[model samples]
Target: MNYQWYPGHMTKAKRMMQEDIKLIDLVIELVDARVPLSSRNPDIDELGKNKARLILLNKADLASDECNALWMAYFKTKGYFTVKVNSRNGSGIKAVEGAIQEACKEKIERDRRRGIKNRPVRAMVVGIPNVGKSTFINTFAGKACAKTGNKPGVTKGKQWIRLNKNTELLDTPGILWPKFEDQTVGLHLAMIGSIRDEILNVDELALELIKFLKEHYQGCLEERYGCSESGDVVSVLGEIAESRAGRLKGNELDYTKAAAILIDDFRIGRLGKITLEFP
Candidate 1:
C-alpha cells in the first residue's frame, strides 16, 4: 500500500519548529508507547540539536510494559532522557518536571553563573498529530495555569502558559509529520488512528494485524472473540464478525464489518497491551 504526506505542510512545520527551538531550553517530545519507532519523526533531532531533549512515551497504559521499557532504554542509548507516561490520566506527569530540570542542568547552571537566578525553564511540546499532544499539554499545564499573554519584543502575539515558578510552556504544540517511508511504520500509524482510516483498506490492514497478533500475542483472538487460534486471518476475521453479530440485511457475514471490529479492537486495546514493533 502507498501513503503520502503533504510536502508543503512538512516544510512549514519544520520552519515553525526551527523558530520555536530557538526560544526553548528543552524539547519535550511525545511518542506513542505502543509504536514508539513508528510514531516518531526523527527530523526533530536535526532541528533540536544542541538542546536538551526528553522523550515521553505517552499512552503507556495502552502498550505493553516490556516494550515501553525497551523503547526507553533504546532512546537512552541514543542520548535522550526518556520517561514512560500515561498522559491522559496524569501518571508519570509529575516526574517530567524533575526530568526537565535534570535534562537542562547545564543550561540552568550556565544561567546561574551569568547572574541569572530562578528564571523558569522554557519548554515546548512536540509530536506527530493524534499522538495525544493536546491531551498532554492540557494535562501538563493543568486547568489552573495562567496564560502569560504577549510581552514586548517577544513575537508580537505569542502566548506562553506559565506552569509554575520553574516552568513555562508555549501554548501551541509543534506538530511533526509521521514518518512513512517504511511500510511497517505506515501500518502502525494507520492502526493508531493517526493516519486517516478512509485512506486505508481496513480489510488488508486487519489481516496484517491478525497475523501479527497470532504470531506475537498468541491466543488473544481466542480470549477476546472466543475464536480458535486457527492462524488464518480471513477465517479469524469472520469468526469475530459472527461472534459480534456484525451482519448486513442478508446476513451474509460481512467482511467489512468484521474488519472494522478487528481494527477497533486492536486500536482500543481490547486485544490487550500489544506493541507492534521494537527499536
Candidate 2:
C-alpha cells in the first residue's frame, strides 16, 4: 500500500510557521525515536535556516537504547543538539533546558555583548504528526500548556507559551510534506503511527512489519504472540490470529483484527524496544 497523508490544514500551518520563524531564536524539533529520519519533515530545514536547532527523540522508552544512543551521536555529528526523551514519563526532560541554552549560546552572547539582558529566548516546537510535540511541551513546561492527544494534528494553530523568565515556546501544528520521494520513508512513518490508520490497509502493514521483525529482530513475533515465525509472513500472521483469538462470526480467523492488535501492540511497545531505522 502506498502511504501518503497531507491534509489541507498542513499547507496553512507551513505558511504560518514561515511567518513565525523570524520571531524565534531556536527550533526544537521532535522526532519519533523508532523512525527518527522518516518522522522529520524536510520543510523544517528550509523554514528554520540559520536558526539554532535541537532535536528531541521523543518516545525513547519505546525504542532500542543502543539505537537511541547511536541516533543521538548521529545528530550531534550533524551539529544538532540531540536529546533522547520519554515525554510521557518525564525521563530526559530535565536535560532539554540546558541543551536549549547550549544551542543558543551564540545568540545569548550576542545579546549580552549588546547589553541586552533578561530577554527570553523564543523557540518554535516543530515535528511531524503524532511525534509527541504537545506532550513534550506539556512535560517540559511542567504544566498542561498544549493540547495533548494520542492521534496526530492535535495542535491546530500557533500558541505562544511562556515557560519561565528565560524562555518561551511557540507550539505549531504537525505538518508532513506533499509527497514522499522514498516509499520506505512512508512505510516507516506508517508503522510508527505518524500516518493515520483509517486510510491504511492494516493487514498489509502488519505483514510488512512482520517481515522487518523477522529480518532484524528475529524471535520477536514468536515471543510476543507465541506464534511460530519460521514460515511465510502470511502464515505467521495466521498463527498470530489464532493465538490471539481473533475470530469472526463464523469462527474464522480475522486478519484485520489481528493486524490492528499487532500494530497497536507495536505502537505501545508490547513487542519490545524496537527501532525501525539505524544511523
Candidate 3:
C-alpha cells in the first residue's frame, strides 16, 4: 500500500495545463482502457471548462471489449464524446477523426456564423503519463502534417501540429497527474504498470490482484500460470512459482519473484483481457 508521488512536478504540470487550456477550443483526453476511472485525473473538468471534450480510451487492446464498451457508455453519460482506441496498433483510430468533428460541431458552427471560413479546430491532447498520448499524437498527426510554431501575440514559444484543413492539435500534451488521494485508485494504477513497480510491495500487490481476479475474472490465473484452481491464494502463488521457475538458492519457492512475474503477466495482457475496474 505504499504509493509515492512527486508533488513538485504535479504543481508545475497543473500550472502549465492552466496556461495551455486558455488557447484551445477542445481537449482530447487519452486514458488507459483497462482502468478507465483510476487512470484519470478529472481536474481537467475545471481546467477545460467551456471547451469541447473528447475522451479516447487508449490501449483498448489490453482490456476486455465488453468492458471498453461499457466504459464508453459510462463516459458518454457524463457528457463526453468517448471512443475505444488502441493507439499502438491503430484499432478504432479511424473513428477518432469523425468523433473530433462531431464533438466540435457547435464551435465550428459558431465560427461559421462569424464568417470565419475553414478555420481548423484548435485542440490539445491530454492525459496521465504513459497512457499512449504520444503514440496517439504521432499517428493522428502523420508525416504530412506541419508544425505551426509560436505566434507573435501568443505565448513566447508554442507548437501546434496542423492535422488537416479542419483541425490543428497542440503539439505538447498537457500532463495531468493522477489523483492518488484514493487508495484503491493508487492500487489500480500501480497494477497497470503506470507507476514504477519499485515503489510498491510486490507481494501485497500480487495478493490484491489475486483476490480481484478470483472474484471478478475467475480462471485467469489458472489460464496464465497453470494454477490448479485452488481456493487458497498462497497456493495459487506457489503454482505460479512452479510454472515460472521462481526459486531460491535452496530450491525453496520464491513467492516474491513469482508475485512480480504474475503482476507483469496481467499488466502485459498475458493473464487475460481483464478490466481492473468494472463500469
Candidate 4:
C-alpha cells in the first residue's frame, strides 16, 4: 500500500517551527523506540541547524532492551544526546534534565561568561504525530501542561511550558514532511500509528505486519493468536480471524476485524517487546 498523509496544517507547523527555531537553544526531538529512524522528520536537521540536539526514544518500555541500547549508541555516535524514556509512566524522565544540561553546557557557559544568570534553557520538543511529545512534556513537568491523546494531531498549536526555574519547553504540533521518498519509511510510520488509520488499508497493513513478525520475531503470531505462521500471510491472517472468532453475518470470518485486533495489539505492545528496526 502507498502510504502518505500530510495535511495543510503541517506546512503551517513547519513554517512556524522555522520561525521558532531561532529562539530555541536546543531541539529535544522524540522518536518512537520501535522505529527510531522512520519516526524522525528529516526537515528537523535543517530547521534546527547549529542548535544542541537531544533525541528521546519514547515508548522505550515497548521496545526491545537490546535494540534500545543500540539506538542510543547509534544516536550518540552521530552527536545527539540520547535517552530512553517511557513518557506514559515517567520512566527515564529524570535523566532528561541532566542530558539537557549536558547538551546545552556550552550555551550555559557562554551565558555565564556574558554575566547572565538564572536564564532558563529554551528547548523545543518536536516529533511526528502520535510519537508522545505531549505526554513527555506532561510527565516531565509533573502536570498536564500539554494536551495528550492516543491519536495523531492532538496538539494543534504551539505553547510554552515552563518546567522549572532552570528550564522551559516549547511544545509544537507534530509535523511530517511533504513526501516520503522511501515507501518503507511510510510503512514503518503507519505500523507505529504515527499516520492516521483512516487513510490505510487495515487488512493489507496487518498482512505486512505478519510478514515482518514471521521473519524477525518468529512464533509471535502463534503465541498471541494461536495462529500457524508457516504458511502465506493471508492464510496466517485467516487463522488469526478464526482463532479470534471474528465472524460477520452468515458466519463468515471477518478478516477486517481480525486485522484491527492485531494492529491494536501491536500498538499497545501486547504482542511483546518488539522493535520494527535495528541499528
Which pairs, if any, clash in model 2?
Answer: none
Residues 1-279, candidate 3: write the lDDT tens digits: 666654667777888898888888999989899999888786888889799999999988889989988999999999999988988788888898899999999999999999989988989998887788999998887789998888555567678888888889888765888657778887888888778787789898898999888888888888777787666778888888888956899989989989989898887889878888988
Each candidate structure's TM-score, on Cα atoms with residue i matched to residue i, is 0.96, 0.91, 0.96, 0.91
Q: Candidate 4 — which residues are off by over 4 angstroms?
A: 144-159, 172-178
By lDDT, the best candidate is: 4
- TM-score of model number 4: 0.91
Worst 10 residues of 2 by lDDT: 147-156
lDDT of 2 by residue, 1-279 (tens): 888877566677777777777778999999999999998888888788889999999999999999999999999999899999999999999999999899999999999999999887888888877888878887898764443222233234556677777788875533445357789999998998878899899999999999999999999999999998899999999999998856889988988889999999999999999999999
So what's the TM-score on candidate 1?
0.96
Please give the ranking of all candidate structures by lDDT, highest first, separated by commas.
Answer: 4, 2, 1, 3
Q: lDDT of candidate 3 vs native?
A: 0.85
Look at candidate 1 and tell me the lDDT of residue 180. 62
Give the whole-model CA lDDT for all candidates, comma-separated.
0.86, 0.86, 0.85, 0.87
**Is candidate 1 or 2 superior in TM-score?**
1
Error of 1 at 243 (Å): 0.9
Candidate 3 off by > 4 Å: none
